[model samples]
Target: MGILNQAVQLAIMVGTIRTLSWPSANESRNANPPEKAVHRQIGSDFDYLMLTRIFPTAVCRADDDSVPDSCEIPTDTPEWSIHGLWPNFKNGSYPQFCDGSPRKFDSDLIKSIEGRLLRMWPNLYPAKTAHSFWKHEWEKHGTCSQNHKNLSSELLYFRTTMAIDTEYSVGSALERAGIIPRSEPYHLEDIRDGLMKELSHGMHVQLNCLTDKKTRQILLGDVRMCIDKSFQPIDCPRSNAFQPATYFTGHSAPLPSFKECPPLVTYLLETSTEPSHMLGLGHREFAYWINPLIPFYTGFFSQQKLKHELLWGITVPFMAVAIFIYVEGGRGG
Candidate 1:
């Protein structure tokens, strides 16, 4: 009887350890993202390039019209991830789907720097793999830049984006200016000034914002900066070139407006109660294995089927153990 009790306790301990020890960031790097189909279009000349960085927390929580289902919301630490590095014309028009006849988005080209890309330029929408997002960017915007020597190849384009992304990180700039992410709102001018003060060569950046439908409050979206053919920082054109183009998200509706933010803008931060990004699993799965009693996490487990599955997964094992212990005690008595 003593041996039986010891065995049960050992099994439970092993299970707990296995459940708690999820895969590390280093272990989950074998993700194979799918490729996208490219269409043929006439190529055109471009004046300068634009690099866009997205604030994930704001993107996930702000939009009420069509929120992404599986956004990779980061931890409490604020960071902006890459969207794309685009080639644009002077008149705010950009070419897309240019002729990269021999070149496709070869994942092999970026294998050496895959880890860095995953960290710096992760796809916010998890329903789609990061590869899919990269392929889309390459096929749509990157191909257009083949005319430029530095951005002619797929590897060069991605490498350039990563280098520039690190050099001009919006999160780091904001933190330096004492504008950290929080539930509280910040004045639009303070946000703009903080970003501009840190830029080099008096370079200009465009600030874009989204409106939360429920509260009708403004939230940060993308921070865009332009660069010349020499890859040096330059002020964005004074024209409406900052206006988001149609190809923004594949949605015909107009993209979020620039310089239209309210006086006060909300910059959301991840709450301690919610799951972090390194869990290597979906929110529902993490909640089920880690803590099934968190009723407050109902927002995460909104699907009825998912809730039932989680309930069964958590309750059945404990119930079986309880029954086994009761039978052994009765026999001993």
Candidate 2:
């Protein structure tokens, strides 16, 4: 009885799958032409985040292979070296951001000064600007004396209003574009919320516009891979929530459900009163359907293991149905 039932289910799945036309060679070619043929925006919120945060952090940490338990420098250190020197000092130069008195010192002393400045200022200067500052400092301070002509020059250059204005201008641009929002901003929660909201909206638009099934699938798989690779592991209680529209609205709808009646159907039934019932799936249904496919949508489940479980749970069933159908069709024929 089990074998017969399985065969029947398989046949049904095969029939449904066959009814959905796969893209032909010509159609496939037409759907995805050369990059020049299709006009695509080269940027996204994720790209912005990567350019602003991930990439910079990666570059900063790359210099130091060791992973510290905390980002905070010890009290004695007085400065944390991110990519190069202290925050106040430019990259590749000694620090000179002393108090009222300019401390004249050799390369080693400069290094210590830079370290102290880093602890004090943290992110006082951008990496690039800091590098330039260091260059000037090196040239000016290579020669030192009690009169301290080199120290005087370095101090004068740092204290100049033009340099300060330039740094502020650059930092302001980064902040405006939602890069480095602030040097020492206290609103990490706000930043994360804004980033996630922007990412969700961007992903939705991109996935929605992708009409080619193979391309869409490939893109989705790539997205899932990224999520798996990037996030860390954590433990938490699981929720059985699902969205209907993103799943049932597309070619995936006709597949047999693992559940007797999918949550999607219930969601649809609830919102059936609307006039545009068939125009597109309801929000709940859409959310239910797309939720499994979009890793970003599962923001609450930040843990890596939960993410994998959610993805595997959705995909395994769907793929199993597909495989069963393909195998059954061969036997029947």
Candidate 3:
């Protein structure tokens, strides 16, 4: 009986250790299936938050078909502006339209900074309401980050986002590195190196591109950067999964050819007076879907799912069984 009791304790300890040591499925596997992707109460699920900023000119260029006249351009100076600040796991799977949060998005909550948000985070299409873009961002991404005090409420989330956006301007960084809007194409590596030089502190960015189907030319689209829970920049995790669409409308049937940028990319201004050296392209809407539950890292999870789930499912049960056997054996003795 004494031996059995010792064995039970040892088993519990081992189980606990394994649970702690095991890499989280959230951080290893592709995202859980859409149905099971409920927002867990904000603990250990996310590694860092991603700040996705887009080139307005490129976005406008892509939207030529849907609302060509509606595409908003930053005229004062060309700038890369906020797309959304998403809570991302290390593996790249992110929870969207998070469940169980009663907090509804209120435009009034962020009235104090509406002016700033307009300049920094406007919905590229002017046909949408002033708060339309912001509301979607809050519900789809900001809600998942409520656990942090700095981002606990809708107001704080937008405010915090603006503060971060101001601190880190991808356009400024690129310009400092001498990579600005130009008709000539740039080597993708040079763009990466330029960003690294300007946004130092071990900064890393993921560059996405808009592909012109007509010419098959790649245009610089957006740059995604990661920040830890405390909001310090961190190297983004690698994943080649299909990211969620930025627009509220369901993905277009003939989706705009937006994908990872190729080796050479054109960083031309959409409003450029010069005749476009490349053919014009159609746009993908950037609105919020009522329930855009798509996972950004689809292919990344399949490989690690079985191992992570099996071990996690067994850990607690095995420990319980060990304790029960020990108790029963002591009684028999």
Candidate 4:
């Protein structure tokens, strides 16, 4: 009886081992299944550029309205302040005349003008400084102040003495500097008046453009140009399915997670009216939805399903083992 019991036990052990070692049909098949549909790559470059560059520019330049006219230059000789070009000249004295001494121009006036320009065109020039030439006053007793005042007076004197036709000397200087053509009739007052009108009109237009959304498109274009110059184009994937799909099972089977795919078709249908400039933004939104967490959840659920199947497969064997133990113990007793 002892020998028979030992043989039975050995046979039971062998049977248990064989049953546990045998592979299920599903396991064998799944071990080397075909790749799943979820595998794909991500492409993002074009989308990013549109978001950061194109939209803002169009909005800024379309709204401006102010345009310049042809008047508004200072005609009478400008008064010099104590801190103006020639503070050393006797106050109200124009020495070249019987009782005339040069007066300095006001430093504060120039500074105010420069400040206005800087605010209007912040992108064009460097930030204004408190100590800029426009802000400095002529020293009352300094030789430098006297010299500056004298030089300015001399220019005014020369300009006043010259005939309107002889103003060509001014054009000669401008031509040599390559600013204007020598053949063009040079009228200092006319040029100065034109510049003032142009500046006023430009400021008005800029303000108008910034205020009106429709007109701001021009400003926005300028901004876009600047951004484009700063940014370089890079190669990126054309389609959403370029990234490889993640797998949950350690098995070589490539099963793509449907959840990981972007809803490109739905997005296209819904936002059919979206402009080409905004298409990339739309894609970015879609890509963000397909984040890494999505695949992780799919993998987790897959693992749970796999575990459930594995546990179910062993359930009958576990019950059989329990029943066999109960029977064997009863027989031994």
Candidate 5:
């Protein structure tokens, strides 16, 4: 919402939408994110990246109808696609924007592997948006990972992820175990148990979901499993699954809930118009929905209040009058 808000402001100022790319400031290498003392001093070294994948169209479409212009979900794209490979802290506080490397991400690096990524990590929003998903991932998570640990550079990170995704295609694993997505809802354990049999190590994974708040129907979102520094998928530590920061630390800090894969989830196939961008915002703008007043607010009610005045300062109203002599004055003689 903030990104679009800024874009709209820029559009207002420049009298044009401009190109999808963000202005010079955001494009530059990220300014150093403030350091977290505890994270740095305790010396957080993540055991692994929870390489996750999601069936965006399924979960996103179940919840939203608007697809962005930038979307291109390949017809052959099987199962779920790469969500992200998140670096998990031992205490569940993951590192982000880790060292502030000066190197800016090169978008062209992804061109050669475009087809693979589109099937795997295509943008979920702003259908016609700047191909910023790769950049966002690099800036947010990839940079946090160390070179010797696993991912070395931008290309290496993307390539390694692709390799991992290829090796353990979540959809294939599930289908091999007789678990396929359909219209019916399934229990969390059933889906988890099915994947466990197919995976080599019987990985400990979490099933993320996007639930319809009104209908209370949980839709499967992402499948996240732990991968060691060697890039092998492994059983995720329970601590990493639900970081108990609040319980262990006993601070006022709120604990992160495990809502992504709540109980009683569904695996419904989407049957709607397939637009290009991520679904949540395109069909219905997320910003307005979050306000909690959308149900009561009407377009007709708000339209009356849209007026604006052009004056920069206070204004005083006055009336003008005109007088004219009648032709009867000459006829009076």
Candidate 6:
């Protein structure tokens, strides 16, 4: 009887997943944002937080790698570096805009670390306007953080994120584990193990695979590691990610592309010395998906004249049901 019931649920869910489609990036962006309000409670302190870092070079994107003349990137930055630090639930759903904290980013605070931010924290969408992106993140997620006291203030949020980035360079961690990028497929477990050495606190992390829905190719997007309130690593809690849309109308929920990756994937390296044609995957010049869950990120689904233009993930209400089927299908469902 239980199995029969699950089958019914799966049938409905798969149908919903099938209906999920992405509207244009402009449509999603131009969405009339919901009115803001003060958040009373989000949940007990997070099971773990993910400091997701992005690798610009690894993306099949066409953004000019050359730094603007006015700014400078470090000589030894990763192809991908810092994206943002996010508070998440073990189930994966998280709260957003927890408080009606004013949405303001301290210019002086960011200016203190401008060089690194210039190189590491890039806005993959617009050519060079990164300030807007930073502002978006703070208003949406930073203010929602439960550890605001430990975080102290807005400046503390950005500063502490940078500190985490400095301490854990996923690129450096993988290399130490003999996980070199720019080549053949590397097992997902191997990648996690490699990170284990540098990430001594716990092996609770998620590997994000950025798939080019257009190019039909996949590459690394961000590496998300789980941290506790005191900022220590903890075994990842099973993600029961919250749906922001139901609670906050007009607010799209943030979720990952895939919970786990295929058995094999290339870590990927950027070789500027070689022409893009000579290199595949990691070295191409194509745009990819916008992580909607990412604060301050407008979807990068807007296209360029690349060989493989991309679109964002189109998850409909039914899609969540479909995922439920996929996740529970084997459990007597």
Provide backbone clash counts, one per model.
0, 16, 10, 42, 13, 18
Better of 1 and 6 by lDDT: 1
Which is the winner by lDDT between candidate 3 and candidate 6? 3
Q: How far does residue 91 in candidate 1 sit from its true spot (Å)?
A: 2.2
- Report lDDT per candidate: 0.64, 0.26, 0.64, 0.25, 0.54, 0.51
Q: What TM-score quantifies how close candidate 5 is to the native fold?
A: 0.59
Ranking by TM-score: 3, 1, 5, 6, 2, 4
Per-residue lDDT, model 4, residue 315, is 57
Query: For model 4, how does the per-residue alpha-carbon lDDT over 97-153 read when each residue is reduced to its tens digit?
Result: 111233333344334344432322122101223233222221111112222222233
Q: Could you tell which candidate, 2 or 3, scores higher by lDDT?
A: 3
Cα RMSD of predicted structure 1: 24.3
Which sections of candidate 1 miss by over 4 Å?
1-44, 63-68, 74-78, 101-103, 213-216, 242-248, 251-259, 271-333
Worst 10 residues of 2 by lDDT: 217-226
What is the TM-score (0 to 1) of candidate 3? Answer: 0.67
Tens digit per residue, CA lDDT, model 2, 1-333? 999999999999987765443333344235423221211111100101000111121112112212222111223321112211111111111112232223332333345345544443233223223334344333322222112222234333233222222332322332443644222322333332333343322121111011111111110100000111111111111221111111112222222112112111111111222111122233444445555855663454455457677867766886675445433332110
Off by over 4 Å in 3: 1-44, 65-70, 74-78, 99-102, 212-216, 240-242, 248-257, 270-333
Candidate 3, RMSD to the unseen true structure = 26.5
Q: What TM-score, over all chains together, does every model reach?
A: 0.62, 0.19, 0.67, 0.13, 0.59, 0.57
lDDT of 1 by residue, 70-170 (tens): 34443332368888998776544555677773356888888988888877877655456778878888888888887777787888888989988888888
Write candidate 6's Cα lDDT for 1-333 as tens digits: 999999999999976764443223344333333422223233124445667776554442222223232111234555666667766544344545655334455556667766766666665443336676677666666766735565646667777888777777777787777777654567777777777766635566677664433233455655777777777776654453422212111122121133245666656544422223212222122112122333322233233332332223433433454444333321110
Candidate 1 clash pair list: none
Regarding TM-score, does 3 or 6 come out ahead? 3
